[model samples]
Target chain A: MSVLDKIYEKAKANPQKVAFPEAENEKMMQAAYETGKEGYIKPILVGDSTRIKELIAERGYEESVFEIIDIAEESYKNDVVARYVALPHTMLKEKAIGRRMENPLYYAMAMQAVGDADVTFAGIDNTTGDVLLAGQMIIGLKEGISTVSSIGLCDIPGFEGSEGQLLAVGDSAVCTNPTPEQLADIAISACDTVKGLLDWEPRCAMVCYSTLGSGQGELIDKVKEALAIANEKRPDLDIDGEFQLDAAIVPAVAAKKVNRESKVAGKANVLIWPDLNVGNTAVKLIQQFGHADAYGPMLQGFNSIVCDCSRGAPVSEIKGNVVISAVRAMGQK
Target chain B: MERKELEAQIIKMVAQCYNADEAKLSVDSVFGEDISGTSVMMVGLVSEIENELDAMIQLSDAAACKTIGDLVDKVEEEL
Candidate 1:
């Protein structure tokens, strides 16, 4: 089965509660409705409850299919805010928390923070900035993760590599150019993400223009440091690197180029690009020229499963993402 | 360096990091909206300023900087 099929199967087997902060958004609602209908996820639509119910009813769907959190309701809003403030290390006054809770995005994050929801999904109407800020302030980053990043899957049409035709790439959508520390975090997050989403024993390669000592530059140094940091932090994970694309995924090239014992060099199922430039361009090339289907850029490194989809993404892609997020939430919680 | 020159230098550095139009940048440019990728760019700026000025910059302090002015203020305090 395909990665999406496998993930969807997992999602179907254990549908997690995915809270949509932008519940009223057309594409988001459609995707949530479809995912909920398919039993891949239990959608918790957070926004104007009346309108949400109207949308559900208009679509010939049962209102019983969704659990709508009426952001408009005064008592429920106050209760969420109260619960958020009462969480350990909130550091925000009740009034301050209540004030920010006016935004549905913050409200959803607050819900996740206080266990009212499982996963917080957004980024259609809200900028990535708004989502990240809410996630940072409310849900907070995972312990030791300093920034939020993303991971995506690339299923190349004709090219077979590690993990079959499926390979995972990261930091393509959210971070612009990751620093060494952020890159390390991205690598670790990518490993965990694939493990959660694909159930693969992650062999991650930190990619660059060089493979070992074949080339040298400041950029190569950055990739090297990233691998070091990732290895130091999570020694159990098979995260290795400073490999070129060939060395990363091609066994022959890896044998010729990589002079050290590295589990990830040839058998890498996860390729962590050194920066967003490499990641974004690589994914585009694969999609346009290689005729591959790019799966994510799903946001990671948060305390909870947080996601950000492109505003222009279609409802089908959104459903796939929701399914991906649901399966991830299943593994995480 | 005087505060004026320091702010100007930081702004130019930030502009370089962002690859944004230097003419549009200012102390008031919000980190998230104006700069878009604050974590990476701000880390670069902090490291650049630290190396060029021989000043220590904490990444957490840099992360806390919400605006270009806030970053400049942090640099000044460090200096």
Candidate 2:
């Protein structure tokens, strides 16, 4: 099966409540409706109840398909806000938190934070900043990860790698220039995302400009430090790096350049780019030249599955991202 | 490393992150407004800076860094 097909299968098999805060946006609402109808997710529409109902009528979808959360309901808002203030370590006053809850973005994140939703899918009606800030201020970051990052799954038709034409690349959409610790966070997040969605063993490679000790510079040191930190942080996973793209993916190149034993050398399914400069450009090239379908840049390192989709993404692409988001939220606590 | 070198590295990173001109991004450049950055982008930059300095930056402290200079000062204090 194609990687997307596999992800679709997984999402269909285990449908989760993927909440849409931008339910007022017609395009996003329609995408959420279709996603629900297709059984890829049990989409929850979090917005004004009457408007949402009207949207459902206009869109001609069954209202029962989604569990709609009425953000306009004072009682529901009170309960969510009370819970937010009551959560340990929450220092924000009730009035302050209530003001934030008025925004659907924060309300949706609050749903996921309080266990009412499995995934908080946004960035359509909301800017990337609004989504990220809401997620941070409400759900907070995961333990040990200082910041959030993302991972993209590329399915190149002709080129077969460790996963048979599917390769996961990361930090392509976030973390412009990661330091060693942030790189480690990206690598760990990428590993978890791939393992969650694709069920792969996650042989991740820390991609760099050089292979092993073949070349040395400040850039190479950053990548080398990232690999060490990742290995130390998630000792259970197979993550090795300080290799060029060729050395990371091609067995012959790895054998020639990396003269030591490694688990992820050449046989890597996950490619963790050192910085966003390399990452963003590489993925664009893969899509343009390799003609690959790059699945995501799925946002990671949050306490919940908070996805950030492109603002200009079409309805179909938006639904695809929602399904991918739901599939990733499958095993999260 | 001198604070000047540290400040220069931060300017370089902020420039690269936001596609802003490095010369224009002073330590006073407000993160969201000045550099056209978002909360998400700032996290990576500050956390990376924290790691570089091996400084412990609390979440609240990180949130308080509105300008690049504020972040550098926080890092310096922690260092």
How much TM-score does chain B earn in each model? Answer: 0.89, 0.74
DockQ of each: 0.07, 0.06
Q: Mind listing the fnat for each candidate?
A: 0.04, 0.04
Error of 2 at A227 (Å): 1.5
Query: lDDT per residue, candidate 2, A163-243, as tens digits?
Result: 888999998987888879889988998888888888899999998888888789999999999989999999999999788
lDDT by residue for model 1 (A1-333), tens: 877788888899988889998987878988888899889898999988888888877777777888998887899888887787677755345765676677888788888888878888898998777676667667867887867899888898878787778988887887778889889999998889989888899999988888886799899998999889999999999998888999999999989998889888888999898888888898898899989898887888888888877778889988988888878888887
TM-score of chain B of 1: 0.89
Q: Once superposed on the true structure, which residue ranges of model 1 sit more than 4 Å away at CA?
A: B1-79
Model 2 residue A112 CA deviation in Å:
0.7
